[model samples]
Target: MYKTKRTVFIFLILLISLIVLTACNKASSSSGDEETSKEDTKEASTEPVELTIAARAGSMADALTEVVKQYEEETGNKVNVNAMPYDNLKETVVLDVRNNSGAFDLVMIDDPWMPEFAEGELLTNLDSYFPDGLASDFVQKSAALGKVPYETGSTYAVPFIGNVQMFFYRNDLVEKYDIDAPQTWDDVLAFAETIKDEEQETFGYALRGQRGNPIVSNYLPLFWAYGGTVLDENMKPQVNTEAGVKAMEMYMKLKETGPKGVETFDSDQIATSLTQGQVAMTIAWPSWVSEVDNKENSNVVGKVNFSAVPSQESDAAAMIGNWLLGIPRTSQNTDAAAAFLEWVTSAETQKEMTILGAGAPTRVSVYEDPELVEQYRHFPAQLEALQNSVARPRTSKWSQVEDTWGMYLSQILAGQLDIQEGLDKANEELEGILAK
Candidate 1:
């Protein structure tokens, strides 16, 4: 009986050993396969895609970097950002996109450029790429800014920056001067002249004197005030008419009260000059005014207050300049780019952006945030202006028009040509463009 029991125990031990060995081999094989799959996924992503984003000046690049870094950490992708100054973008963007150099995978452009870029099919239509697409998530006006107009269409770009021209002045300065906030465009011109003649060292106004975007930005308010439209309802050049002539003449008068080197003025010059208290009142954008409102660098903090642009007809007609985000046709990472844009434009992200001064939010919910209302007392005024805000003529020919009119304005301001003559020259150039 003892011998039989020993035999049974020996067989049991041999059977257990064989099963253990088989289980170990199976686990080792499974582990090897998992490692192989992981290696393949890693290799597939190792192709070294460097997404180059070309943009104009604003706080956009900084805000995008935080999101991009998080994306890179999770997905192991790389992003390279090129923050181009506003002046160089128009010329460089066209060259890079047309050449198909795969140089810029993403680009930030002013809203006016959308018609041209989208019509040319230079930017990829974002509809095919974005997952939760533009369905009622965005405000209508904001959404319209990104779509191809007058046609049922998909998104061509995302509105990342909501920039509108606002009028700002020093409350303390106005009170001390016994000046009521100028209610009319004519009042503004009169105040500007008083500051120029009496203030002596300080300029009545600090205007953007640089050509192209800078000059055009400064002149548009005057154009609107004088009842001039860049393009009529029929999209014809109405820029040299009686209203247009009056607008150009007002621009000439602005030059008379401006700083000595007004021709060289740009955003940096205007912002610093305003905060330094050299300027009494000026038509500035949210981007520049934010700089002056900053506690760290601003001298006019708690002293500066903003108002709507004084009206020539109804109110000062400030031009709306929106910056949009879009993917390029050559982008290999369209899915990722669209994902980022959707997230960034979301209400939650836009609130965070507002706190960081990334730009204004596109959503009505965030725009009416109580915290923002406390911070920006002019929010009510701004909201009204935004609702009625004028977008530049939605045409593919804007790039050429901006250049032609911008050059003509510079010449008029520089005294190289009379206002009428300058507009005459601009009209000829525009007529040719219209013909083409």
Candidate 2:
């Protein structure tokens, strides 16, 4: 009886030992599988990738091309850039993503088009990649353009070009007129009048008076300063308000101070006017800053000075027109694209871009770089303007609104429609557009 009881106890101990060994093996196997899976993922992510980017033509594309060259050299990746004009690029990007074609791994976007892309669910949710959120070194307003709800919401893109409207004037001319830098629209008007009357060789101001985007852009700073809004708190058009009419009146008055055929000037003409010393003052983009200082292109090199736009009832608010980089939802190479974006927007890369004369820097550090500030004297003012900037109304219908509003603004400039009639007509058309 004692031998049988001892046998049973040994048998039970053996069974328990086997169960413990099996559990240990299973746990070890599971851990090994997890580690191997992670290694595979890491290997895949590090493999060289071939990517395609749809980039806007001109300096933006040129800058990106240079950056891509550096990125390829460092990562052993290959990138093919298909650069096209703005409208064509936008159409291709939208169509490719909408159809799930996966033709572009990445694309450049104008800030205003972000809403359309976001609303259509066409961009990847970038929040996951940026686990800690965007770095604070990025200009808040410029970086805000990447968000769907303007300054708030999940980021879908990063600002690539820090293009903001800058008030450009010939410092020599302003000083010659014995006036302080024009701090208010009234001040600008008076300065324009003085330059127009006395400096017969130079117009008081140059206006981007062409219809559509050009005219609307030219008028916005004025409209906003006068407390006018494209859309009120309720998303209603208020372009014909008391302030709007006053702004328009001021806009027309400024036109009188410009030279003949002011109704047809666009960016090229505006830049030419300022660089050639034909205009004493104008609102221009940072893209023109190089031209203003290039001795080969500018007659007034070292003479033009930039500042924030003049204020009125409201504080000065330069319009933010940053170009953004976003990965498409249909992209097959999103990881690689995100990597490139992270690299490009870095302070170091942006500084290189600025040095290459590609585009304006979106980073505060890059803008404040002593070397860059020295080369581009407008850097300081540009930084200030970017910080104090305002984005256009965050509506997918902004293109339509700008179009209708531009048509009337052009007419108002040409005397084809009176100010009140033009504003009323534009406001009505904008209402109809928003309703849709």
Tell me, by lDDT, which candidate is best: 2
Q: Work out the TM-score per prediction.
A: 0.76, 0.93
Q: Would you list the clashing residue pairs of candidate 2?
A: none
Output the worst ten-in-a-row residue range by lDDT, candidate 2.
352-361
lDDT of 2 by residue, 369-431 (tens): 888887788889999999988899999999999999999999999999999999999999999
True lDDT of residue 103, candidate 1: 76
Q: Provide C-alpha RMSD values for all models, in order.
A: 9.4, 2.4
Q: In candidate 2, residue 154 scores what lDDT?
A: 87
Worst 10 residues of 1 by lDDT: 379-388
lDDT of 2: 0.90
Error of 1 at 285 (Å): 1.9
